[model samples]
Target: MTTLPSSTRRKLGLVIDLDTCVGCHACVVSCKGWNTENYGAPLSDQDPYGAEPSGTFLNRVHSYEVQPDDGTAQLVHFPKSCLHCDNAPCVTVCPTGASYKRQEDGIVLVNEDTCIGCGLCAWACPYGAREMDAAAKVMKKCTLCVDRIYNENLPEVDRVPACVRTCPSNARHFGDLADPDSDVSQLVAARGGMDLMPEQGTAPVNKYLPPRLKDRLDRTEEIDVLAPFLAPVTDQPKGFLGWLDKALDKI
Candidate 1:
């Protein structure tokens, strides 16, 4: 079985803002497109246009209606992918050492060449991040777009993960978690970013910012702050509108 490194040089991961994710799936589409073209074996699909279509995807968005004690029911869009955990069970459970964690950047990856299409990694992963590519017959998961991140040919701005780049709402972030001064780390500190299932003890690198509750609209006792703006300028037509109204009335 494989073993994890004692420590990694950097904890590179994502910081997802639950408040801003719009559930548009742009990240999912971009991930599929980029990985298929540049990364390892193509992500396969069976009957893509048919009724029962299924395919391998590294990123996915799941929406759920949640009700908080202090707020009304709200729809939350959650994007899930490989967390690249510090204590990655998938890496340690791999019999052939096909799955391993990088000591350089702390990215968990599967060695497809040495991978015997074994589903051990999938079983060991608590997040259900791994998916089987039907055509390639190999287990696949998110690689944090490792190829794009370190490429010198690409512009510095485009070095982030495809999900972070394509997020229309600017909900996704990528940076070194090991650096206390990184923007991602600062955002996490400001927003109180939390881990996914801390009870699992996987120590996932990715963090999620909790959605801030919307202002209550149903309460009648409290004064509405936008009352002035909500009030009309005048019930009767006035200014340019008054002139237009008089002309229309004459007609």
Candidate 2:
């Protein structure tokens, strides 16, 4: 069986803002495209155009209609992925030592070459993050886009996970969570981020910011279509033209 590192030097993970995610599946599509083209073996599809279509995917968003005690029912988009836990059950459960956690960044990964497709790691994972690839016949999980993140050839802006870069609503953020000053850490602190399932004692590195209650989400009143644009742009004249108008009046 595999074993986890005592500790990682860096806790590089994601900070997902639940309130901002729009559930458009942009991240999901980008992850599929990027990982298939740039990373490991292609995510296989079974009868994609047939009766039942099933495929492997690293990141997925599940929408739930959650009714808060104080607030009305609202649809929450919960994105799930590998948490790279300090006590990863999947790593320890791998009989062939194919599953391992990185000591440098705490990113849990499966060695596909050594993997026997036993599905033990997938069963061990609590978040349901691992998937069985039909074509590769191995367990596939989020690698944090390791190939793209550290590639020197790619532009700096494209260094993050494809899910983070392609999130249209900017719901996903990737950075070193171990760094107290990192943007992801600060965002978590400010937003009161929480782990996926703290009771499981996995010590998941990735965090999720809770959705803030908004009065607008539940209000049944009809919105005035022109209410916002009705407001005046400025009491004073607009920029350059305004200055010219004033100068001409003075003349």
Candidate 3:
């Protein structure tokens, strides 16, 4: 089994806002497209034209309907991927050195060449983030767009995860979470961000901004106080990449 790094220099991860996400699946598609050509391995698809079709994707969005005590039901869109835990069990379970976390940026990645496709990593991961690539016979997961984010060939402003860049709702954010002053950290602090499953003791780097309750409140005074902070959905930028650039500038 491989041992995790004693400490990582920076915890680079994602901050997903459940409040603003619209369940568009734009981020899912963008992640598939960018990762198929750029990273660890080609995201494979089986039986594309056949009756049963299955494909590999690094990011996925799920929707759930929750009813509050007041009987108001809300549909929440949840985007999930590798959380890149500080004490990743997947890495520790890997018999080979293929599964390892980068000490520099804390991105967990699999070395396809060294991986034996034993599925131990997948079994060890509590989040179900690991996927077996049928074509390569190797396990794969989100690398936080490590190749693109650090690529010197790309423009400085374009150096972010594909999902973050393509999100139409501006719900996904990327930055060094270890830095208290980073935009992502500030956003997490302001929005009361939370870890997915804290009981697992993985200490996941990613955080989720819970949906705001102001919209559900019937009190006019409560709504008035939150109105100033909430931007009108209609007023959001329509152009996909254009809106991303604007949001990145703020971060």
Candidate 4:
């Protein structure tokens, strides 16, 4: 039903830079602002004015404290969202065909119009990336901002997703994962990056590169373990020697 070329397969994906990321919430805010307005459904809060308030988010930054057995502590902030995997389980589990991946750019998109309000997609996801749209009564997830990225009117740099554009630390990246020579691909190759929950065999196209940490011994606290023996000043006369011993004790 489409007229695009067969070789026009878009290898749509995200490349998050762990080196430059400062764990700022700028990307989170930018994603919420853009997707909630232009996308198919807006992320809404159930009881915004009530005691408990929660909203659907396509992107969330999670901060974790990692401690080594050698009494070393480290802070790790990980931002979680849909990986748009090559073997995406969310698409296969959808009974109504609402959840589908774009053949054009390899982006996972949800068709709210065809969705039957079933939460099957959410359960199938291992990353907890999908969230239900309370207002639309359907499952909602990241679209990679297809509407904005492909628009010819916007500048080339701004053509990327909102999250990538608004990142203060420039942590988020947008590019084609299939391209071995792409910026994202080159960065991953050089940085020794890693993926999240790789054990699930999802083969997620989106990769997570953990922040490099300093060595443990660099911060180890040093203290003198052995005490030096000192001569007994008790037998000395009650003069300069006694006073010196008292001063040493005070020292």
Candidate 5:
């Protein structure tokens, strides 16, 4: 039988559209579902029914309220996940060689068998993408559904990652960033895409398109225009001598 082509040269990454994402939590939920059941042990939750319950998750959506100078608030739902940085610091920090970037596809992955549970890679990740699977004592993170994406048995539509397949708003795209003609690249070019925390200089392969400006809400109407110019009124006396004379006049 002929040998299958290796995945070493392919470039893989995620594209998130801030303009279209409604912060519905579909991607987050779907990611949890796929990862929990498929790879290593289900994300390993601690104290599920307790007061401070938490679980390991590769993807999380954060909600931010941005307040403008006029006291207007905008609710921005930003999803936080591994951007799979081109210069991934996590890979270099791993002493066991468990964390590595695929030369063929540019996908960062952990070799579960070789991982020693040192937790160094997790500390190297600034996005908090890597989590220790407490049950397995190994680090876990987004694989980008590697198993599903390359499965020859699945239909073309089903070949993408579970998270991308389940996104209802179509806010996520997965493809090769190396090729400019790819759909993800086109979308990024059409929109002014940017990397989050570029100063960190991880060179995140993933890109986020900022949201379009919404209709302006008028806050000027809420403030009384004459309030600053209007004088303060008081029933009390002024200066001592003038007050006495004014009181005598009034009486």
Candidate 6:
């Protein structure tokens, strides 16, 4: 069995906003595209375009219709990935020491060369973040784009996780959670971010911003109904009215 570090210097993780996410699946597609080539192993798709199509992915977006106490139903888009817990059970259950957490940045990663595909790590993960690649027979999960984020050849602005870079709604943020002054940490504090399933005791580093409450419109006042037909004009005016008449004629 593997053991985690006593503590990490910097707990790097993601902060996802449930309110701004549009369920676009852009993060999913971009993650698949980048990680398949750059990371530890290639994410494989089995029988793509066939009757049953499935593939390995690091991030996924799930949508839910949630009805609040105010009586308005809202569609919440939740994007999930590895939380890189401080006391990760996935690391403790790995028989081959393949799964381990980095003490520097606190990113959990698997040693593909040492992994025997025993599936223990996947079984131990409560978040269902791990997946078994059928083709390579190795366990895979999100590395937070370790290759990209640390690559000096890439531009500083492009050093974030692929999902964060490609999010059209800017719902994903990455930074060191250990630093209270970091942008991600400040955002979490400002939005009242919360960890998922805190009772599980994974001590997940990632935080989720809850959906903002929508302002309920007052319905006590009666609405005035518009007339079904417009009143006939006595005579068509010139100049601006002539242009309006021409546009109405086309309509």
* Candidate 2 positional error at 149, Å: 0.7
Error of 1 at 126 (Å): 1.1
Q: Which ten residues in a row have the lowest lDDT in candidate 6?
A: 219-228
For candidate 3, write residues 24-140 as lDDT tens digits.
999999999998998777999999789999988888999999888874699999999999999999999998899999999999999998999999989988888999998979998
- Report the error of model 2 at residue 135, Å: 1.4
Query: Global lDDT of each model?
Result: 0.92, 0.90, 0.92, 0.80, 0.82, 0.92
Clashes of 2: 0
> Per-residue alpha-carbon lDDT of model 1 for 78-101, expressed as tens digits?
999999999998899888888889
- Rank by TM-score (best first): 1, 6, 3, 2, 4, 5
TM-scores for all predictions: 0.88, 0.85, 0.86, 0.82, 0.80, 0.86
Candidate 6 residues 114-141, lDDT tens each? 9999999899889999999989999999
Where model 4 places Cα greater than 4 Å from the true spot, the runs are: 1-8, 215-251
Clashing pairs in 6: none
As for candidate 1, its clashing pairs are none
Candidate 1 yields a Cα-based lDDT of 0.92
Per residue, candidate 4 scores C-alpha lDDT tens digits across 99-124 of 88777777888889888877888998
Off by over 4 Å in 5: 1-8, 219-251
- Score candidate 5 by lDDT: 0.82
Give RMSD (Å) of candidate 2 vs. truth: 11.4
**TM-score-superior candidate, 2 or 5:** 2
Tens-place lDDT digits, model 5, residues 32-82: 888888866678888989999988888888888888776468887887787
Error of 3 at 33 (Å): 0.6
* Model 5 CA lDDT for position 67: 82
